[model samples]
Target: MSTVNTTPHTPGPLLRMSDIRKEFPGVRALDRVSLDVAHGSVHALMGENGAGKSTLMKVLSGVHPAGSYTGSVEVDGEPRAFADVAAAERAGIAIIHQELALIPQLSISENVLLGHEETRYGVIDWGATHSRARELLLRIGLDENPALPVSALSIGAQQLVEIAKALAKNVRLLVLDEPTSALNETESERLLELLLDLRDQGVACVLISHKLGEVMRVSDEITILRDGRTVETLTVERDAEGRPSVEEDRVIRGMVGRDLDQRYPEGEGTIGPVRFEVRDWTVDHPTQVGRRVVDGADLDIRTGEVVGLAGLMGAGRTEFAMNLFGRSYGRYVRGSLSRDGEELRVGDVADAIAAGVAYVPEDRKSLGLVLDDDIRHNTTMAALGRISTRGVIDPGLETVEARWMSEHMRVRSHGVDQTVRTLSGGNQQKVVLGKWMFTRPELLILDEPTRGIDVGAKYEIYLIVRRLAAEGACVLLISSELPELLGMCDRVYAMCEGRITGEVAGADADQETLMRLMTRTGEKK
Candidate 1:
């Protein structure tokens, strides 16, 4: 049996990646990148979307085989070559991707022991697997039965399952790519605690995240990547001694390549008369129809008004908006919606469009985009019927519209023909926004609008949101980030346990108050 050698005061670098290089067809994904992570320290990789953060983690985990890139990776003072993921796993390297790699139909125990299932004389050992999975769950502060189907679990619970899977691998080094991207405050904190526990157990972790605040909170060292190159590697402590003053600021500057005066921009303007309103609205959960996700809700947005929906992960904020939009996402939805003082029959997404409404869903990769198609195709998907003539599609019109949006939104791409899948998360989100924006709707519903976006891209989206509101278009912003909502929205509605617990004007809203309402459990007002 092998044991990991790790401690806060342990000597030498446990892993060093030197002059790493990887190139995709037309893009240089990684170029001469170098980063060093020490045992027992949480090293954070920070960068804007497509800044090659995930690529580096993949390389280390052998997702991109050792031969696929130009680099030298030394673990425990010895050079190594990992032919594939299995080899990497054998070498104590384990990575959990941003998008979870779990099969919904599989049981929790099955997911934990997927690749290396327990067996006795070529027979599946279900009893042993369940016990092992249960043990791993305990390490993650969970006590759920291993036999439960993964589909029965919520996204947050599923994340814990992934963590357990990593533990099953006897990992000495762990890599988490945007682990908290979809997590709410409580879930995020819990996940962080588990990582700390693992670190205490002598495991090293590499955290890749765009959330700078959380990154700053947990990271022992920081590495910034830019345009596939390693800009700098920042060591938080020097030989177990804290760095000098201004070290944090120095790290932030390196990550962004400039000093960002603000984390979120503050803007104010006139919020004009009731453009959209929802009264006595309710939406039930998808699986549990009898249980209401949103009990009864009331919301209003005036022309040029930016209304923010603030809540925890299960606060029912998204459910309320989704059910009212076009009835496209929820089940057993009963809602009354009005637009411009007239009743709106939002039966489905198309009906919502007819009422001058547009929705940008939260999941861009799955629901918001056509992965195999080019950007031009995805940009015009929502309004294809409008762009088409008598059921015969007009490629010329689509191309023209796509080109205009690509330039207008400042989407970075080789051309409109570039595959949407190849673009960065932020750029893909822009495509989602562009598709809905091009329709020229009177009211826009943005769900987590700036999520997973870098500081520079977030600034651009903020400007876009402000511009839209300034143009007398109603904006409904739904986000988990309290700072963003408070900074941009004209008014904020705080939801808790599927109801609007409180509503506050933007001028008076703050993290403390919003969070108070967001986490409140009981009959929501």
Candidate 2:
């Protein structure tokens, strides 16, 4: 790895944003916020959803630009006025957002050196492009051919490609927003190791993540924000063995402005008789012929029960849920679904919804909600007929129902008329949940329901899930986090390679036991 510096530097701190205040139409997103990042160190930016963490980063990265906000940005003790993202890059700053910016159809080399490509006389130079791209890819530990399209790579590999593009710009200070939210455990560890390596190479990083364990591991300093204001910044204490010594509770206190005695709320719902059942479920890969994505899966969910599905990535947990919910994913080879002792003939999404089945997909942004639409429209999207008459929506009734749902879901926004994209991630997730809850389903399938939200928002979501179960709704909760399953579920089913390996009661389940089942093969339970 090589250290790249694009500007003349005499540094105490590598970057500083002093008293930044930004405002949208009716909201003051950021209020007099200040931050400083030391050279060759990792600084974590922690906060609950809508705490202005993203807004502050946008101000620093020139997304909001210079005149759009009131602030002074200093790089290496010299004031910098960044008119756009290009100007920020010239000053050796790059930001990788949660949603990666990469063209799917473009090759790895092309995406890496998209804008800053080498030219020969009056033409393009392919040889130099691939050579430089290969060098950057090696630095990030991504061993793949540079000519392959970015779509062929996993989410983790594509993330590394984004980093390679930043290195191509000679970035000295990098900002990563929820870098591992979409990754599996292995991929996340790899990315964290890469961050530590970059820090050792004299690059400063501003990390914004909701995962406290990862934030505590690699960060040198932690800054907490609350309600668009600077709370306090704490230096991470280290033990003699060089491990972090700061308690996670202390950081949580600063972010939510209170002590969270319990990270996961206790379930108060009582398990009842079986209300939903699946037998001999099998689904083949959509494009790959004769390959079963989900095979011979059987499960039962009782009324007022919160069941959990546990597995590693690509273990067919999601595939099984989607196949059961109106065959939304994969090609259904065989499956028998029954609800309330009656067989269901769910050929499509409408049929599933009509059969009282609701699915909240894992990728909420792409599959659940229309980002450009308002909360009112999204909340009423699943059951428009409830708020419509004579095949036309009533504007007054829509407002009444949407407002009620927003309040019921505890969505924080300017108004029901506010655009869904402008809200924070937690609030956006609330809208997705609200949309599905409007359908009044007997069985609700929540896939990775609390994937990217903060701890406080996660607790609220847990409460909502419990409330639904208490009201006699059967909930099938799928999560990658093991602790989540153990905390909120009455029973958990482990799947490995498209087969159910074991079933465990939540009271007796532990990480080790679940791991054994998740990795087991050859036997179906």
> Using lDDT as the measure, which candidate wins?
2
Extract clashing residue pairs from model 1.
Answer: none
Residues 117-184, candidate 2: write the lDDT tens digits. 87799676988888889999999899999999999999999999999999899899999999999999
Which stretches of model 2 miss by more than 4 angstroms? 2-8
Candidate 2, residue 438: how far the Cα is off, in Å: 0.9
Q: Model 1 Cα displacement at 487 (Å)?
A: 1.0
In candidate 2, where is summed lDDT lowest over 10 consecutive residues?
2-11
Candidate 1 lDDT over 1-525, as tens digits, reads: 123344233357778899999998788999999988888778899887788998888888888997899989988777978889998988888999888999999999999999778889998899998988887888788779999999998777899899789878878889998898888778889888877777777788999887776776678888899888899777654444533322555656776688878755555566778988888898888887588888888889988888999988778877877887787656845668888778888888888887889888888888888989999989888778867999988999989999999888889888899999889888998888898888888989999988877777787788888888888999999998887888888899888888888888989999999888877778456
lDDT of each: 0.84, 0.92
lDDT of 2: 0.92
